[model samples]
Structures are given as C-alpha cells and as structure tokens.
Target: MTAPGRIGIDMVPFTRVRALLGGGLLAGRMLSADERRLLLDGDEPDVPGIAGRLAAKEAVFKLFHATGETVPWQGIEILRAESGAPWVRLSGRAAALARGAGIGSVSVSITHDEPCAVAVALTAPDSEERSAP
Candidate 1:
C-alpha cells in the first residue's frame, strides 16, 4: 500500500508559463528597483532558462508545502536526466524543508512543445523511512 505523505500538483499550460518566466528574465535588468528586489534579489542565471527552472522551483515548494518568501527562486535548480526528465535540486530553506520531511528523493517529469514546457513533480522518502508509532 502507498504510504501517506504530503502531495502537491501544479501545471501551467507550457505556452503561457514559459512566456511569463522568459519575459520576467529578459526584463530582469529593466525591472523596477522594487521588481528586481522581488525576483532577482540574488544571483540568477541566463534569462532563457528561467522559465523551465521556475516551473520546477514552484513544484518543489508545493511538495515541501512551504512558502518561504525569504527563499530566493535561484535556490532551486532543475537538472535534466538522460531520458529528459527534470529533477529538483533544492538549496537553502527549500532543501531544509525536504530534509525535515524525511524525503530522500524527488522525481520530476517535464514536457515541451514549440515555445512551451510543462512539468510534474513527486517527493518521496527513502526506503529507510518508518511510519510513526
């Protein structure tokens, strides 16, 4: 039987979401001093990759069920598998939350068509996990 644990699901029709993130990245420099403080307060990567990574980032937050506003979006990175799956690599508070939840692994799947991309994520504990008494 499947064990009980936190589960979260989020999807943005690849087309629209990609555009939102891509645009946000491009305008990073153009962002108002206030806007910059919100999304790009810390180090960030090249603009084009922002869309895919941001999608994965949101997914991780959902799995951890945390809304750490202090956590920078850059803390979550999306690593690709040979089969083209995107995996979550969390850092900072996000990583801490995953560890606290006893999650030993995370699984993610991403799909793209034309100018859009979509992803689904699952977080699970290692076999070492034991149900509470």
Candidate 2:
C-alpha cells in the first residue's frame, strides 16, 4: 500500500491571463496542442477557459511538488470530459514521476467567475483499494 491521497488547490485571475493571451506567447508556452485547440474552438472568449485550465495545471503541479516531484508546466494536461468534467493527463517526465510516486489517479475540479478561476486537484494511490479482496 502506498501513501494516502494528497490535495492541491490554485487560483488565477482572468485579467492576468488575458494579458498573457494578448501577448500570444504564454499560451503557446504553457498549453498543449489539444488544449490550444479546445480553447480556440470554444464559442466564448478563451480567457476564462484558459485561465481555469492554467489554474488546474498549476494545482496538479502542486500535487506533484507535495510528493517531491518536479514536473514542467507543459507536462500536465487538463482536458474536459464529454460531460464537461475536467480531468488530468500527465505525460513525459510527469508520468514517470507520478508512477514512481505510486499516484495512480489525478482528479481535478475547476471553476471560473468574472475575475478569477480556481481549481482543486486530488492525487490518490493506485487502485488496489478497490480491488482488495
């Protein structure tokens, strides 16, 4: 059995993220291809959504950091489910670090309101608890 779950939370301001988007470089540096596509494809202005996703990613990084792992900003991907729920998908060194830390699942919740976006991340050990007999 591994350690118990860990939680991380983060918040970002929409105005700050909007300025970053205006510059055109921060989005490319921080978001993955799929994430960029999702943001751009939305009907609403992309600032809030992008800010929420960025907060979610930062929350995930905090989770990893609490576990003593360092992952790049680009290594964490936050995606929306068909039902519009958010989830996390790690890649490259992030995946390896998560595996080594015995973190089998990472769940994220995001919310946005006029000026700010907030996210909470939960990281749990492998699924053995469900399979225990």
Candidate 3:
C-alpha cells in the first residue's frame, strides 16, 4: 500500500550564501560537481542560483529527517533536468536510508528572487507490484 506523501520546505537568503561563497571552497563542499559546473556556466552573480540549490538540498534533508532518516550533506544531489526542472538524486548513505524507509522517489521545486530562494520537496512511495486476485 502507498503511504501518504510528505512535504518539506526551506528558504535561504542569497546574501548569506554569497558571504559563504566568498570562501570559495564552500561551494565545492556544498554542491556536486555537475551543480558546480552549471553554476559556473551560468551568468555572473550566481548567488540566487546557489541559494536556491542550497534550499533545495535543505528541503530534501528535512523530508528525510521527518521520516526519521539522517542523510549526509553530500549524499543528496539536486540536479536540473534538461528542461530546467529541479530534481533530487540520492546516493551513499542517503540512498540506503531511503531504501530502508520505502521511499521510491522525491520531487523538488525551486524558486528564487533577488535576496531569497525557496525550495519544496515531496516524498512518495515506490510503486509496488500487485498480485492477481
């Protein structure tokens, strides 16, 4: 049987992230390789994008936490589809935890305006095979 969906939301300020990015290494530490590439390839002043992704990651983390799971910062990767839609991919401890929790997939939505960014994540059950009656 499918369980009720769980949602998590997070918001962050670009100014805070911009200050953290000033350290240079913080971005590499927080973002995956592909995410870094995308950020670099984008237009200048990527603070909003960075903040949005950070919020996305936080939202996913909160979702897992709500389900009594603790995933590492790098264990959850947020990537954009070719169409520019945000999505979540889990790996390492995060993936193992999700599997144990019966979480099949997660959907993410991200939005940003000058000073702030926000993200929402929704968790759903994996589709299960049914037997013929």
Better of 1 and 3 by TM-score: 3
Query: Candidate 3, after superposition: displacement of residue 110 in Å?
Result: 0.7
Best by TM-score: 2
Cα shift from native, residue 111, model 3 (Å) = 1.0
lDDT per residue as tens, model 1, 85-110 = 55556666666777766666566665
Question: In the order shown, what is each candidate's alpha-carbon RMSD?
Answer: 8.8, 4.3, 5.4
Per-residue error (Å), model 1, residue 68: 5.7
- Higher-scoring candidate on lDDT, 1 or 3: 3
Ranking the candidates on lDDT from highest down gives 2, 3, 1
Scanning candidate 2 in windows of ten residues, the lowest lDDT window is: 124-133
Instruction: Give the C-alpha miss distance for residue 107 in model 3, angstroms.
Output: 0.2
- Candidate 3: residue pairs that collide: none
Query: Per-residue lDDT for 20-46 in model 3, tens only?
Result: 878875456777787778685666647
User: In candidate 1, where is summed lDDT lowest over 10 consecutive residues?
Assistant: 26-35
lDDT for predicted candidate 2 compared with the true structure: 0.77
Each prediction's Cα lDDT score?
Answer: 0.53, 0.77, 0.74
- Stretches of candidate 2 above 4 Å error? 42-45, 66-71, 128-133
How well does model 1 score by local distance difference test?
0.53
Native-to-model Cα distance after best TM-score fit, residue 55 in candidate 1, in Å: 2.1
**Candidate 3 — worst ten consecutive residues by lDDT sum?**
124-133
